[model samples]
Target chain A: MICLAAFIVFAILGIFSATHRRLAKQAFWCVLRRVTFKPCQASIGEILKGKIVGWLLRRKSRWAGWVHRYFEVFSWIFVIITLVSTFYTVKGAYFYIRYGTCNPEHPEQCLISTQAALEKGVINPYYCNDK
Target chain B: MVENSWKSQFPFLMQKKNGQPLIYFDNACMTPCPIPVLEAMEKYNKEFFSCGGRSNTHFGRDVDDKVEETRELVAKFIGAGASQEIIFTKNATEGINLVARGLNLHAGERVLVSDREHNSNLIVWQVLQKERGIELMILPSKSDETFDLAGLEAELQKGIKLVSVVYSSNLDGYTLPVEEIVKLARKYDAFVMLDGAQAVPHHAVNVKKLGVDFLAFSGHKMTAPSGIGVLYGRLAHLENLSSLLCGGHSVKDSRYNGFELEDIPARFEAGLQNYGGIIGLGEAIKFIKQVGFDFIAKQEFELNYFITRELKQIGGINFVGVDDPKSRGGIVNFYHEKMDSNQLTIFLDESANILTRSGRHCVHSWYNSRGVKDSIRISSYFYNTIDEAEKLISALKKILGLV
Candidate 1:
């Protein structure tokens, strides 16, 4: 039910956004611009020379942008990974619920031994994977 | 797919190696592909790669159309009354397995099989006998590997329920009289299944006129890609049998308590099928139609006669079956006086780059029945020339001299 809701929402948004070309282009460009590398405040000399060796040297810390970049990359990766995993889980669950087995092709026939089916109780009759 | 002549269809066969044009004599095992099959597969993979019948979208409908188009082509090729009678399977192995498992054979019910069957037919029955308590009865073969009709009739008199036989012997290249066998089996109410893995490519098969209960054939052996096969069941027989595999797509409606299965073909297909392979297989059949079966059979017979004449000169080599072209299709299986088939195959590969099927050709029981271990099989296609047969005979002599 949740997947269906999300799919419907996304499909409608996709249709609406496809028609609004300027807004769609602006949104895509914003993401592209955000991911692109920016000029760093840290000078080459300061990067090469450590603070302990050159106490007289003064430079601004680029710690804020560096931290932001790390968080952005990590979050983007996390979102993509989460979405992919959710899809797999949904597919697996769908087949399991529909046929009472992961493999729909040989449902009536036992791919596994009868003993394994008795022990696992509908979990993976073919293999004794840890429940 | 647009139809083209054989000369225009497969230019690959005309390709030359070492200033000599190649000759392909390996059709009984696998045939060379024509351009239409490759193009169809490529077009589907690029344009219609989606789940068919599962999703209600343009791409999904495209996939469904492609799959059904192939099914119709295959049905027409075999003279099936309706496309719904044809079920797409992975290969001849899976197609046979589908029948083996789907039909519930009891402990006392008998399955009569010939000794000349390929392992695809033999081992499946054996597995069923071992697992399901079904009894398997073996029918004897003639010295030339032809079906012993009297022996089969004697067995039939004993009240057998099913008789599965090969339409053509891949080991010895003899074409069985399937129409006679079918008529005989029908008299006793015994179902007949024909393994057309060898015969379908070389000749025309009218399933309706043949009046067999089922016919199984693979695509790869007939210029299509591998991983695709057809299981043609009479619609009435399929209606009586229960499918072992059942899933969402195979069902019409469900109330969480009971479900109704779909019609013949849909009820049999329980998962995502090989859509591209089926589409390509359809085009392959179209290509074969353009070449004309009469021309194909004549070319194969001429080549078979030429090979038999050449091999007869190489004395001490024994061909297992009758050497008459009228009796066989294109396969010619023989063994030398004192040469291991594997060793000879290796020698041919190394010396002449000739490809031939060695060992029992997946029909171990056939060899076991003859009290022999294995034989070398040189099967030919229409594309093969008389010169290649001579070259193969020359290579056999060289290998035999070493023995």
Candidate 2:
């Protein structure tokens, strides 16, 4: 539980920092244009050249829409995997509480309903053959 | 007082073998001691060298008190009922032999043992069965060189007198299901004796909670001096058993006609005791406790993972035991058809400055049974680092390629 809470807090802090950097970059570009008293920053040819090189080298393709769609699909898959693993760890911990550990001999003892053993002063609810 | 590093404890470990620093990975055979254990033994040898409980003199009484204090420390460490239950022997082998010799095994009775047992645990029973006209029932092991629970249960269903097993296989650091074994022994009315040479140092071994009748382990494996280890028997069993060795301190009154015996522990501990070694063992355990078992387990587990991953990359190096740290401890065993284990060890030592144990590891019968002629073993302790493991892996790969 504590680990989950810590992860959430760190995630929020990371997103906040990323947004702050993006906003700062936009503000700086606007200030530079105003200081130079110019409506436009660069020639279309120069901009197109840089974009083409970046797109081919870094962004992979000129079809920006499909690239963004692929990234979004992969990002969602990554998030799902992370969330599933988090749940798996939580499940393991819960089972550890229910049955002491994952002793193969007593797999049934790892269930949550084995809490009655705790009342009976049997702290190791996980030992499948505790009886 | 708080010596945290391995070099500080076992300075010899840091000494260069060739041009490289000695990377000792044979912990299953014996561990290098820390400074505190050495100092404790030094104090005993230099200042307080007296036979315990033999004389009423000042030195004798002081030595007696120190011996008892050491006993108390060992007893508490294992969670034994009392200091009286803990018997100081030469080593775990002698301790197990004591039980084999002392326990009353009838001619028709059976002694149960697992397939994964070290020869120390196996051969003693075999010798007893041959000498004393008892039957030795060998329990089958699983495919992974581990005790088969179901097969063990089938064996336990029989009328067995004693169940002698290893808590962890020195061959591969595979831990047995101790709690389950103890429970089954209870059902069959058998006394369980654990060869805990591999388990005690790396993990938390609470004898009372584990509820075994007798437990034996060597001090050398736990960073103590050799020839001074323990045999922890329940007080009832200790009182009931016969002493195999008899001499000074064991008898109450000796005459030309007859002799009367003293109380247990002392009765079992005959001759002039290993005063220096016992005191050193006590200090070694104290040193381990100070660092903490949990920390030790965690460090060794990480090392085990690194070793497994690295070794897996090398082809034909078959690792024994359940590769997970949660199930196993810090011992890794591997064998290759290309080279002999001893040859591998020699190359690793001469070329790479890595110290590894090879061959049967005192469990000859176990190796023979599985058709494994020899195997290279790398057992780690908390003091071992990932870098040392890498060195060992590289050496092994080099040796493997050569063969």
Best by TM-score: 2
TM-score of each: 0.71, 0.73
Worst 10 residues of 2 chain B by lDDT: B1-10
Per-residue C-alpha lDDT of model 1 across residues B117-214, encoded as one tens digit per residue? 88999898888899988989988877655788888888888888899988887876788889889988988889998898888888999999999988
| Candidate 1 Cα misplacement greater than 4 A, ranges | A1-131, B1-22, B254-258
Q: By summed lDDT, which 10 consecutive residues of candidate 1 chain A come out lowest? A: A50-59
What C-alpha lDDT values do all the predictions have?
Answer: 0.73, 0.76
- Which docking class does model 1 fall in? incorrect
TM-score of chain A of each: 0.30, 0.32
Candidate 1: DockQ? 0.01
List, in the given order, the native-contact fraction of each candidate: 0.00, 0.00
TM-score of chain A of 1: 0.30
